[model samples]
Target: MAEPRLGQMNASFGEGSVVLRWWEWGPADGLPVVCVHGLTRNGRDFDVLARDLAARGRRVLCVDVPGRGVSGWLPRPELYAVPVYAQCLAPLVAALGRHDWVGTSMGGLIGMAMAALPHATMRRFVVNDIGPFVPAAAIGRIQAYMAGAPTEFADAAALEAYLRRVHAPFGALSDAEWAHLARHSARVAPDGRTVLHYDPAIGGPMMAGDPADIELWPLWEAASARPTLVLRGEASDLLLPETAVRMAARVRVETIPGCGHAPALMEASQVALVADFLS
Candidate 1:
């Protein structure tokens, strides 16, 4: 069978007029499902899951959040906050009429904020490997890595190796999957060196924040009132077992085994879990 036709579009948001680029799949008239990627990752992270959903007759829209992928970087790095992303995405969600949301990490936080809105058009939500409460340790870990990240790599092999080390928490991805990730996660610099696709300046606002736990319980409480599913990596340092237990009281929580911080959702089982939920 032929692969689903992939298309792209751009939307300008915020006073800075940052351009947000997104990928689309499946028939235009199909049920809409929006997939948002994690911090430092682009919409291409959802290619596997999106293709499956598209084949199932669902319209899948995967976003390249500002500063990542083909999306334009923020005029000010401070605009990298979740609230800013939520604000930028609100119009797109509203335009979809009614839709389902699937977000990973920072994307999940953005979804929470959007879902909490007074008249949110989101029908169902799937939050992947992140919660309202983010521990300071996790924040520190991310900051340390970002601070130490190499600006460029000698070749694709070097970049892929780096990605494997940092994103090993994304569960057991196959060789081809890792290659796919590397291909989308990086670009060739003018100097002919491979570099990460996201803007390095994004780390400025991220590190400027206090080195304390991030609390977004209010957003969680409001968003959880709607139908929500939380996917937690069994060994995630970010989403502790206790936290997932607490979240279970308000929404369904599924623990994906063998992963640390997040599940890639590229596996057949992982894709099925999400597809079944949205259905």
Candidate 2:
């Protein structure tokens, strides 16, 4: 299939004037859908899924949350919290008028907060591989990896290999998919080393906070009033089976088998599921 038309825009926030970058796909007048990526990940992670939705006549906006992707890094890394992300995204949400939201991991948390806003513009919500209650063990696992991640790699192949190992829990992505991920996930440093694209200091706030299980049940409850779908990886350590069961009471829950932590949602089946729900 032909590649979808892609466009980029920037929105500035805060006194220091941080710029948040986002990519747009499909027709300008098509039904809108906003997508947000997880921590340590940028907006490009939604390329496959966003393209599919765009082809189906939906306008897709994939945001590179502050400190990630090509977006400008914050002057103070301590502001890298979900509340800050949600606040920064408020203008974009308002400008969209009304739209559907697809959030992965940390993005899901931001979606919950946004959906709870008094004037929230989000109509339907799709949270990928996360829940209202994130276990401390899962948080620790992510923190450990982020803390020890290599700053530089020998080359593109080395970076791809590193991504394949660390993100193995993203499930069985094909060779091309992995290559696409690595291509957008890193950039060439002045020294010619392949470095991860995001600001490493993005982890400062997370590490500084207490290592307790993140509890946002209140936000989830408020957001649950809207049409919502929660996708969980069958072997996911973050959104446990019990949590999924509880979430099923308020919103639809679907388990993506053969993965842990999260489902990449690049597969036809996964994309179709999300598209169908939004339709």
Candidate 3:
């Protein structure tokens, strides 16, 4: 069979619009599986996973969420939360009819909120290395890096090296994979400088929100009607092991070792686990 072709969709949100880019593969009429990446990452983060799911006879749609990747930046950064994301994603899902979902970090949170919504479009849900009750210490760590930082990298390689230092937990991705990630995550400037692809101000809403003194169990429980699987990195600081166990009460939980806050499910073995769950 020929290599699966990729398709892009533009979801209108106001006059500016929010582009919904996706990669499609496998049979034309196969089950749809939508993959969502983390806060700073793009839909291409699931290139490997998309291929794996495609090969397994699933139509994978890896979305470049608003404010990340090729997608346009949200003019209202204040609407950066999952609820706002779901508002945009709802139409995309409707266009696809119905589809399963896999999300990491912020993406996972988005999927959870969608599943909770009445008359949701999600068929099944898989959360990669994130949970409802995130630890404050881990939140602090993420906030430190997301705060706009100066980058003097001359090219993509220099920027990749810097990314490797900050996101070391993404695991040892191959050169080609790392190259792919860096290409989507960074852009070369006119003056020989490298910068992250999306607007750093996109993080404003995230940081501006007051700390939640309450638990997010209510949000997580809303998706109880669906078959949900939560994957946690054993070394993840964001979702503490105790909290992961607690989330298990809501759905099946699995722990992947030798990983940190988020585990890049780029490996074939990792993708197999997701395939098995979606099956």
Window of ten residues with lowest summed lDDT in model 2: 4-13
lDDT of 3 at 194: 81
Count: clashes, candidate 3: 0
- Estimate the Cα RMSD of every predicted model relative to the unseen true structure: 1.6, 1.5, 2.3
Q: Which stretches of candidate 3 lie over 4 Å from their true place?
A: 1-6, 12-16, 190-192, 209-214
Per-residue lDDT of candidate 1, residues 120-172 (tens digit)? 88999999999988999999999988888899998898999999999999989
Query: Which candidate do you rate higher for TM-score, 1 or 3?
Result: 1
lDDT of 2 by residue, 1-279 (tens): 455454444544555456778878888898899999999898888888888888899999999998888887887878888888887888788888899999999889999999999978889999999999999888888888998899998888999999999999999999999999999998877888789999888986778765678778888999888999999999999999999999999999999998887899898899999999998
lDDT of each: 0.87, 0.88, 0.78
Mind giving the per-residue lDDT tens digits that candidate 3 earns over 1-279?
A: 454465666676544567666666777788899888898888878877777778888888888788877676787767676777787788878877788999999889888888888888788899988877886667667777876455556777877777777887877778887788888788766886688876676676557754342257888888756898888887888778888888887689988877786888977778888889998
Cα lDDT of candidate 3 equals 0.78
Q: Cα deviation in Å at residue 21, candidate 2?
A: 1.1
Clash pairs (backbone) in predicted model 1: none
For each candidate in turn, the TM-score is 0.95, 0.96, 0.91
